[model samples]
Target: MEIISKLSILIVILFISCHSGRGNVDVQQSADSIAVCHIGAIPSRFTALHKDTLSYEKGEDNVRMVFIRGGKFKMGSTDFVDAQPVHAVEVNSFYMDEHEVTNAQFEAFVKATDYVTVAERPLDPKEFPGVDPAMLVPGSAVFTNPSKVDGMDNFLQWWQYVPGANWRYPEGPNSSIRGKEDHPVTQLAYEDAEAYAKWAGKRLPTEAEWEYAAKAGNHTSETYYWGSEKKENGKWLANIFQGDFPMKNTKEDGFETTSPVKSFPANAYGLYDMEGNVWEWCSDFYRPDYYMQSPKSNPKGPSSSHDPQEPGLVKRVQRGGSFLCNDEYCERYKAGSRGKGEVNSPTNNVGFRCVKDI
Candidate 1:
């Protein structure tokens, strides 16, 4: 996977996946990072927290759930270095959102509770001690799809930090979610997802539970959540990259970006877009070697996050691949693979669904 080497200067964002050989480059040498956003930084979006206890029924009214009769399944995969040492793990049955949290859902939560997303909040001077205040404007990572690239190592070729890019404006100041109400909400940090989950009386699913529900009944097998083939009877199963990576998108899957929820068929467990569309944030703190020492049943990842690539920044596990996953560059679209991102660095390709305990 293409990893974001550093966010110290321009991007101020999180990294992407830990997929394959990037052939290592000096983190400091290449510093002409993504350009800053055009607009001025947003004013105080902070709102007072509500003290009244929220009633579960108030939020549960809109949630459509699928009962995951979770059982023992191989928690990790040998395909990638991170999801390695494939081992047996178990999880109790629980309820999960039928689809990813939609823009409509998040918009409702924001309006009802006056919640402001992390991407909307201005950056702190303490985070970047010497960095220019102008570049510290609030924004999130957005894929630009560069014209031509040398190799896959430098992910900066595609991802850019766009100011004024929040859930309301997915791409930049000009973008909007007018008619895409049912599409999965993107440009959200882990806490943004967590906040929506909390308001909905739900929690982000553990990586184990996510994989279990994603695998459906195909546990212990190396098959996709839908099936072994990428297509069935010449029809694409999920929304993923179709053509050239970072340059040309064939859009063979009928969507160049996020497709509306249920645009594709549901998995056997009645889950929609479990593999692609947008990467879903899990409740687990990411550790590449977590599975090596994970317990047999109900493993909840490492206690604290640690990415050898960027040790100082804390990251969380992001499951499922996005529309950008292609064979040439990012093939993490395969089953049993993993992706991660910094806790506060929201990106356009990552969003989340929620789960509730039985």
Candidate 2:
């Protein structure tokens, strides 16, 4: 099993804290709140939800989850509203897959249960209300060659909302997963991840638990999981876009697109790809001001929001940034960073990992 060591966890915390941009927001004071120091303060035990015990049985090359002892740690980012206040959060001990669920793992699930992802099916015309069929055309996010010609910041140029794009056809109509069994499954909706988790006797990690586990048992507030030192002690820790945004990947990390899980070193918690590889789905509704109203212990976000951005008020938090993220455009690859997308919107850059009660 892959374990993100306690040391790496500390590095992530410290690095992220330092990297968090300066904030003018008021720091909420807590009567009993203590500045994070002892790593043992975080909770590390959990009640198993599945009766079937999970063990590391060597298989084809999929990385398995490592049990992490949960404890208290600061959740949210110091800079972004999505990660505000850096409050204390405690998660029960849970088992998290070392890497994001890969194409191989998703394939096994499909073969075993004949599961079909939502993106693989067409959207009901009625679901769109008055939308045209052309607009309703089935599609998923695809990486574009930004330099081939034109605008780079916008993802639409390359991430065409293709009509037949799904996990099987990641690049769209003509593309298929034919030879990439080891790649992390993409274009997975939140429900898709939930389905796979159910089949595996696991569930998606809550935002707090996910962040805490990503931190491992580290006590410092360093940026990035590896520490304050850039380039992973003079080496890159995970796969991220290099060169200019959208175009010119340069494969600096040796990957133009997604890399296999654990292609980088695990954080202190022994969790792999916690910072990059793919954007993971978290089980929480995304509210920009959530952290401000969040509880200091085991926050679960708001029951509802008054924000007009979401008409139906439907959105979920995505963590660990994806291969598509770059310093030029998307910086969500950091541990404390975050992004949001519709629960039903599946993209080639979006994927997920699972968690289970210890």
In candidate 2, which residue ranges exceed 4 Å CA deviation? 1-63, 128-136, 148-154, 305-313
- In order of appearance, the predictions have TM-scores of 0.86, 0.78
What are the lDDT figures for the candidates, one per model?
A: 0.74, 0.63
In candidate 1, residue 2 scores what lDDT?
23
Number of the predicted model whose lDDT against the real structure is largest: 1
In TM-score terms, candidate 1 sits at: 0.86
> lDDT tens digits, residues 255-277, model 2?
88778777788787788888777
- For residue 355, what is the lDDT in candidate 2? 82
Worst 10 residues of 2 by lDDT: 36-45
